[model samples]
Target: MNIDDLVKGIAAGERRALARGITLVESSREDHRAQATALLAALPKEREALRIGLSGTPGVGKSTFIESFGMMLIAQGLRVAVLAIDPSSSRSGGSILGDKTRMDLLSREKDAFIRPSPSQTHLGGVARRTREAVALCEAAGFDVVLIETVGVGQSETVVAEMSDVFLLLLAPAGGDELQGVKRGIMEMADIIVVNKADGDLKPAASRTCADYAGALRLLRKRPQDPDGFPKAMMVSALQESGLSETWGEVQALTDWRRANGFWARARAAQARYWFEQTVKHTLLAQLEAPKAKAALSELSDLVAQGAIDPTKAAQDFVAQLER
Candidate 1:
């Protein structure tokens, strides 16, 4: 398809066009990259959506919560877009991509768009093109864009960097699990939610919420959150309870950041971060060219034979790239 058609279709909120645009951006081919660049350039500069990063442990019911939360947003007449990142098989590099099936109701909503992307072994618990997908969704006039990570620990920090608000989801009996999670991830959270807070889990969920609230109090306040430390709450996604309140908290955090000038600064910083990352990616790709590969092989053999030190060999390879 033509670049103009793709840009116009995305701006018009055409689902097919949006999907194609996402596929284009996710493509690794040079031509597709060039086309994606042009498409992004044509998009509106003003961003209007709330970019949220939601993450938790594998079984934390992230998909369920998102469906409930997204439906709530749609009920309020907001267009919600979910960029769900599915974990790729380590051996096959394939993903289940079943988030759409999991979010049956929300996926059927006219105002909600769900896109499941494979992690493709990209670190940071997200797909490589997730940020670009966010831009596309925003350009498509989505009022809220939710990025659901693979929920593996450590790499979640990358999501925190890319989002306006970072929400950490926990399940009942999470007190011990909290100790296992990295303190940095908890520190980055603007809001903490304990899901499955219904039925027999109600009491446990409440306790988990309290435990997280207390833990958050002990950590240094995130500078961006003017409302002080992270706030914790309990909710039942299955029952769809407390969803509105949770959304209200998200809006409150977004408003606070916008009012404090942190929002704009954060987005600007994210843009710069992506720019640096793209440069590194491009350079690394160049290093994988046939000639570079030949040089690398020779360098590896030399290092293995002890004719050249590893560090020196790396420098030599870089020098060859420069030449």
Candidate 2:
């Protein structure tokens, strides 16, 4: 399809056209990439929407939280789009795409669109085409775009970069989970939500939430919204409780960044990182070529035989490849 037709159709909120446009961007074919760039450029400029990222452990009820939160956001007269990343299985290298089934109620909402696409070897539990998909969503006029991660791995930082607000959802089950979650990735949450706060789990969830709140006090706050409060909340995604509070926090954080001029700097940094990644990936593809692959094999043999150090061999390989 031509760029103009696809761009116009997507701008008019055509789901099929938007899906096809994302597919084109995801493709590795050389010609398809050229078209993808054209389509990306055709997207209109829009910066008024809120971009929120949600991530947590595998069983933290991410899909459910997203569904409940999405419903609430739409009820408040905002259009929402969810892009949930489903990673490929280690064995089959194909995603199960189970998020849609998990979000049955939100799935039926015409104003809310939930798309779960495979990671396909992309970094940060997201598809390579996700950035383009987000831009497309913005151009199509979604008031809010929520990008959900595959898990709580270090890959979470990748999603954080694209979002205006990064929220970490936690399931405060009890004793050990509190201390256990104090490690690397989960601590970087701009807003932490302790989910499943209803029913029999309420007491345990509350205690765990207190533990996290204490934990936050010890660590230096990353930065602050204009309100001067670190964004944190406890919510029950299944019961549809506490969602409004969560939205309030998200809005406060975004507004703070805008009023403080941090928003411009953040977007500029995001663009630089995006450019670096594009260059890095292109070079890696060439290094993995069959001819280069054979040379790398020879380098490994030479290094193993003690004929050359690993670093020297790598530099040699790079020097030879450029010729």
Candidate 3:
């Protein structure tokens, strides 16, 4: 479909058009990139959604938690969109993209949309175009957009820049108090949820929650957060318990941010961040041209043979590109 048609369809909340729009945005082809830029520019900007970034270690039941949590939102008559990022195989650059299969029920809901994309070796656990996808979902009228990262540890913080709330899901007894106190992913989380809180794991989940809560206390409070913010909670995604309470906390935190005017400022900062990132990526992409590639190869060989220093070679290569 043409850019105009896609924009109209997205404004009308057509699922097919929204999917196509996301795929267009994620494309790296020059022609598609041009089209994606026009498409995004034409999209309605008035529509907005709550963007939540969810991450966890592998086997932490992120899929289960998302499915249960999404269902709860849908029941409240909220449209939900999930953008799940699957890690790409380093050798093959292929992704299973099996999020739809995993979120069986949510995928089937008329109000729920699930799109899984390959990370394509992008670092920080997110696909390079995930922010665009989130924008499209919001323009398509989703009340909530959930961004699920590849779940790599600690350094997987890029999602926080794009999301209004960052949730860190953990398995019960996964770590002790000291581990929770360590900075990095722990420091980035707005809410640390201990999953599998039902049945046999109840006690362990509670203790884990308390440990993380204490850890949150030790960390310096962010100006954006209200009192008791960045707290820990336990949930049982398997049995769908505590899902409502979790949702309540999410809403409460969001409301607090909105009331204090932090929400708008945060989104503005995110937009500026992505703009800078896009410019950098565009410049890097230019280096993939055949002439540039050849120049880079020659420079690498010269540096390896000690004919030129690596930094000087890089400077000369960049100068060649400028010319």
lDDT of each: 0.88, 0.81, 0.95
Question: Please, what are the lDDT tens digits per residue for candidate 2 over residues 1-323?
Answer: 78999999888888778778878887889899899999998888864568888888788889889988999888988888899899887678888988888888888887887788888867676787787788888887789999998884644678867888888887876334346346565555778788999988888888877777666666665654453345457899888899898888777777788888888888888889888988988898897789999999999999999999999999999998999
Write one digit per residue (lDDT tens) for candidate 3, span 23-80. 9999999999999999999989999999999999999999999999999999999999
Candidate 1 segments exceeding 4 Å error: 176-181
TM-score, predicted candidate 2 vs. hidden true structure:
0.91
Q: Deviation in angstroms for 292 in model 3?
A: 1.2
Residue-wise lDDT of candidate 1 within 1-323, one digit each (tens)? 69999888988999889999999999999899999999999998675788999999889999999999998888889999999999999999899999999999998998999999999999888988999999999999899999999998744778987788898898899775356345667777888899999999999998888887777777776688775547888889999998988888888878888888988999889999999998988898997789999999999999999999999999989998999
User: By lDDT, is 1 or 3 better?
Assistant: 3
Candidate with better lDDT, 1 vs 2? 1
Q: What is the lDDT of candidate 3?
A: 0.95
- Where is model 3 more than 4 Å wrong at Cα? none
Clashes of each: 0, 0, 0
Provide TM-scores for the models. Answer: 0.96, 0.91, 0.98
TM-score of 3: 0.98
